[model samples]
Target: MRKFFDPNLAGANLKDRLLACLGALLGIGLTSVISAAFVHPHGAFLLIAAPMGAAAVLVFAVPASPLAQPWPVIGGNTVSALVGVAVRMLVPAPELAAPLAVGAAILVMSLTRSLHPPAGAVALTAIVSGPAVLDAGFAFVLIPIGVNSVILTLCGVLFHRFSGHSYPHRVAGIAPAPINAALQAEDLDKALADLGETLDVSREDLDLLFGRVEYHARHRRKGSTGGFPTGRAA
Candidate 1:
């Protein structure tokens, strides 16, 4: 309970939150405007899907996450939409179609290494959207879903760059200086394999984090020893 209520759970500072909000507004707003202009009738299917809103959260708030990158945004949503449409066409029943679409989308995204969480919502939308969406067919993947994804991604990139945040973050090629020399790439890989669960952070970022923590720990230990040798000289 104490851990759940920890102040650190709040995460980002005021400035970060402000930037994220602004980015979401800009991305979603522009995508909506574009969507409305092109998608005719402009009723329920107009503009963007509900998932795009969640995508905006990742794009703007957690730009560094692997799931928030350009490929993940574009490919994940597009492929999921495609899969959803396919499932809907084949499976007439909404009950079966909905779950199948989501599952298939997840599998495709995982295989493609473009696993964005919101893509599942996009898949669901494609299935349960009724006759209007079904009539639109595969074109649905291209126009609104694909277009919205591309636009949102572009907006996120521009917004993050302007706001001094890194969008489409690249992992550093060189590893940070390690305090524990025994900590190798293989060790990290083995540890991650042991965990057997997907983490939001990229491998590079995790490695950097471990390196920093070890460095801090070593410094703290040295400081506690008053910068003098702890053991007697031989």
Candidate 2:
């Protein structure tokens, strides 16, 4: 019970939480305004789906996460919407259609390397949004879903850039350190493969983390010794 209530589980500081709040506010506010302008004229239908809220959290709060990147935001949501529409059209039964839509969306996004978590909700929205969404047909994918994704992604990019965070982050692509170095690119890759599960972090980010850790360790050793440690003391 104590382990379950660990304070570490809370994670992130007030500043980070506030930044996420701001990002969600900007991303969703803009999306709602744009979506309402376009859709209100047609009829009363949701311009934005629920998933965009989750996407905003990733984009703003954890910009470095692979799932938060532009491709995941745009491609994942778009592809999932498409899959949802297709499933709804093919399966007449709501029970089968809903599950199939979510599962198929996951598979498609995984294959495309655009696996955003909120996209699964996008898939469900397409299935159960009533006739307004259904009448739009394939247009649903391009208009509200696709448009929403693109707009939010653009907003996230601009927000991250101005907020001192990198958007669409890329790996450092540093060459492997010498043989005597602590860890290498190949070693990291092997370790990842062995884990046999997806990680939110990218390889480059992991490498950078390792580099930072090594740097701090070296500095600490030197500081303790009043100079660089020599021989085995290193």
What TM-score, over all chains together, does every model reach?
0.86, 0.85
- Candidate 2 lDDT tens digits, 1-234: 656534341345667767878988988999888877667333456577778889898898888889999999999999999999888889978888999999999999999999999999999988988877777877888778888899999899888877767888755434444222655568878988999998878777776666655556777867753432121111
Predicted model with the maximum lDDT: 1
lDDT of the candidates, in the order given: 0.83, 0.79
C-alpha lDDT (0 to 100) for residue 230 of candidate 2: 22
- Residue 176 lDDT (model 1): 34
Q: State the TM-score for model 2.
A: 0.85
Q: In model 1, which residue pairs have backbone atoms overlapping below 3 Å?
A: none
